[model samples]
Target: MSRDIRIVTEAQLREVVSLDLETVDVIEAAFRALAGGGVVMPPILSMAIEEAHGEVDVKTAYVPGFDGFAIKVSPGFFDNPKIGLPSLNGLMILFSATTGLVETVFLDNGYLTDIRTAAAGAVAARHLAPSDVAVAGVIGTGLQARLQMQAAHLVRPFDRCLVWGRDPARAASCAADIAAATGAQAEVMTCPASLCEQSQLVVTTTPATEPILTAEMLHGGLHVTAMGSDQGGKNELAPQALARADLYACDRVSQCETLGELRAARAAGLMPDTPPELGEIITGMATGRTHDAQITICDLTGTGVQDTAIATHVAARLGGAGTVIPV
Candidate 1:
């Protein structure tokens, strides 16, 4: 194999990996691959800069049948908006599946990460949420919130949507974006309780150190996807909320213990030592949403498998071999 590498720019990657059912399936396949247990994935490498209100994470995974894998570098600087910069930016490097050659580089600036995260939320809803949904809700007015709503609509069409944020103006803007993106009537909710009450499918995407949605806020048959807590000490859903859920699942149990909704639940002694992984459900090794009246919670801490899957898929789309990157 040659040492030369292909560079896929953010714009090029966006055109290839659009937020649609196909891309969502790619993300789901990554989960299935994880559940199957042949992939080699290390614990995420993370660092925090408290002074800058920023954090960086490095993740990678190698699936047995895939031709290549990707190592993604994701940086989140929450304070960037103060200087008119986006909060998230990063890139991914794809390596050959054989002979350890460099394959392609995706300068996505975290766009692929955002897309896969939202798609994972939708996949969780598809396999767990009640068949019929009236209103879908999202808490937090960030990029993930809007993408979550858009992706959820791909699986289950909701009559309307409710978006909640601490800032009323931001919530309203997010609601408008959801309406435009998904063609669903979207409104801003002042409180998480009201949003939860009005929604059957809810996603929480806030980087709060303290809990936001409580068990009291959830009702029967509600499905919650919490995708914000990807770092230690970060939390969004209350421990009691996770404890009381009829079914609890995370992207990975190991990561959840250190940096997900389940972490808080375990710390408070509200949950068991092991919860089912979402991949298990997707692969049919475990059950998901057996009853319509069940309450389900999915805690996503992000995974390296996702980066590898999306990168491999994109690489093929942009001219890599169909089977695997040739050495």
Candidate 2:
């Protein structure tokens, strides 16, 4: 079949934004697809942003079940503010499950990354968060933190949102924006401890090399989503946090343990004896949140399969020849 080549600009992605509920639905469905064994997403490749000299990594997610590959790369540190460039960028590709035709291409790597990660947070919340949860706390005020908050809100109607970051001004601004967007009584607090004390749902999105959240700060039945630990040397939550969790799931156990929050726990020999993938939980091969007071956590370091899933979703939404192109 002959078709005209159509291109979608970043403006198009921005226009076709899936805020909270839509993001949750997309994410849950992606997990469902993955758990069904039709989707194959592999671990992401990433490195810490060096303050002086920047480094990058290339990661790929292949769904052999789906017969496609989604690869990603983080390329820039964007040190010069005068250039007005972003710190992250990449492209996503999708092939036909059967015919192997080029199905789609997502040039907006940063956008795709933020949304997919947020969606994963929602997936975790769906499985781990209490049905009665009303307050949520965010430990970071960056891009990932915003996505995490949005995704968590879709899982439940948050009556309160507590946001705190190293940069007080950024936290205050983010809190104010969240309040207006979700209509939740939001507060820009100091740090994680106070928010942890009051909220049942907590998400840590900081890219910290040192531990930010201590063991004593956590309470029972608190659903924590660890999204920050995506590199070998970086970690936020302490190993004790994992020791206390009743149920723990990750996008990919191998990847998470090597680079994500699991890295910290495993280093201290405090990692779970039995850990399951998110697909296992989504497919009912495993269980999540059996009791009301059980602590649960999902280590989401990001996956290539999700990047593929979201890329496919975007291509489907943007019709015409947005994906099929001659190289």
- What RMSD does each model have against the real structure? 2.8, 2.7
Write candidate 2's Cα lDDT for 92-140 as tens digits: 5556667666655566756877888888898888888887788999998
The best candidate in terms of TM-score: 1
Q: Compute each candidate's TM-score over C-alphas.
A: 0.95, 0.89
Candidate 1 lDDT score at position 313: 85
Candidate 1 stretches greater than 4 Å from native = 320-327
Predict model 1's lDDT versus the native.
0.90
Candidate lDDT scores, in order, read 0.90, 0.76
Model 2 regions lying over 4 Å from their true place: 1-6, 38-52, 64-68, 76-83, 99-103, 321-327
